[model samples]
Target: MEYQEAKDKFISTWGSLGTLWGINKAMAQIQALLFISTKPLSMEDIMEDLKISRGNTSMNLRQLMDWGIVTKVLVSGERKEFFTTEKDVQELARVIAKERSRREIKPVIKVLDEVSSIKDDGTEKTKELIKQTKALHNLTQDADAMINKLMDQKQNWLTKSVFKLIK
Candidate 1:
């Protein structure tokens, strides 16, 4: 396929996969565009290329920045603010994993801990609730801990091995 067709397919596929990462289609599309661009793109450039509204492009860019995946870039001799994303795929994955842990898993873990720590009133239902929640809390905590450990090791041997094994 031609460059245009290949790029379009990649952006579309990435946008569809964005929902799995808890981002909207436009946001993913914007990231995909930025990810493949040879240089930083202006907001207008992104909007035009994606055929999205100005507001949509702006909002999604802000969200992507919040997620630590995208950043505002300064263009020499250009007034328009430009944007770029993490170019290294491994680094990008690490950032997204860390952010997701903080934003999503951490909150759920907190709630689970709170629910599981409630006083045991000797009632069967209360005991069952505590038991179940504690189990879930422990499991979630372990998973999160593992994820954090993996993310902390930047391009470590183990991480590289794991990725290789997965592939």
Candidate 2:
């Protein structure tokens, strides 16, 4: 396939995969574009390439920035804001994992903790609720802890080893 077709296919596939990472298709498309670009792109450039509205592009760009996956880039001698994304695949994965842990896993753990801490009134239902929630809370905490440990060891030998194996 030609460069244009290949690029389009990659952006489309990446957009679909974005849902798995808790982002919208357009958000993912924007990131994909930025990821492959030789330099930063302006909002107008993104919208033109993606055929999306200005509002949609602007909103998704902000959301991407919030996730720490995208950033604003200043171009000298230009007024329009340009944007870029994490270029290193490994670093990008690390950021996404850490953000997902904080935004999604941490909140679930907190709620589970609160629910599990309810007083035991000597009823089977109450006991069962506490038991189940406590189990879930423990499991979630353990998973989160594991993720945190992995994050702490960013770019470590083990991580590189795993990626090398996969590749």
Candidate 3:
């Protein structure tokens, strides 16, 4: 396939994947462009390439920066900023996992804890509620522990090797 067509395909795929992960399509598309480009691109270049307005480009760029996926680069002898993507897939996964844990898992854990703490009455319904809440709390807590362990072991070669062997 032609270079531009291949690039377009990559951008589309990335954008769709981003939507599944709760990120904006434009931001992911921009990041995908930066990831494949040999050199950093200016905001104007991104806007032109993506066919988006300046405001839209700027907003998505800022969001990507906030997510730690993109970084700014100043061109030599030019005031305009360029951008690049974090090419390390492992780091990307680690950041995404950490963010999801904070955003989704932690809040769910709080709710589970609250519900599980409700006074238990003798009614079958109340008993069922207590049972379900307790089970949810245990499952969430286990997941939290697993995430923490994975995050801690992410940089350790032996830990990764062990996991691969077990799997």
Ranking by TM-score: 1, 2, 3
TM-score: which is higher, 1 or 2? 1
In TM-score terms, which candidate is top? Answer: 1
Full ranking by lDDT: 1, 2, 3
Candidate 2 TM-score to native: 0.89
TM-scores for the candidates: 0.92, 0.89, 0.88
* Local accuracy of candidate 2 as per-residue lDDT tens digits, 1-167: 99999999999999999879888899999999999999999999999999999999999999999999899989999999999999988788789989989989999999999999999999999999999999999999998897777666756745576568978
lDDT of 1 by residue, 1-167 (tens): 99999999999999999978888999999999999999999999998999999999989999999998999989999999999999988788888888889899999999999999999999999999999999999999999999888877776646578788978
**Poorest lDDT segment (10 consecutive residues) of candidate 1:** 151-160
Off by over 4 Å in 3: 156-160
Pick by lDDT: 1 or 3, better one: 1
lDDT of each: 0.92, 0.92, 0.86
lDDT string for model 3 (2-120, tens) is: 99899999999999898676788998899889989899999999999999999999999998888888999888998999998888777777777777788888999999999988998
Give me the runs in candidate 2 sitting further than 4 Å from their true place.
156-167
lDDT against true structure, model 2 = 0.92
Q: How many backbone clashes does candidate 3 have?
A: 0
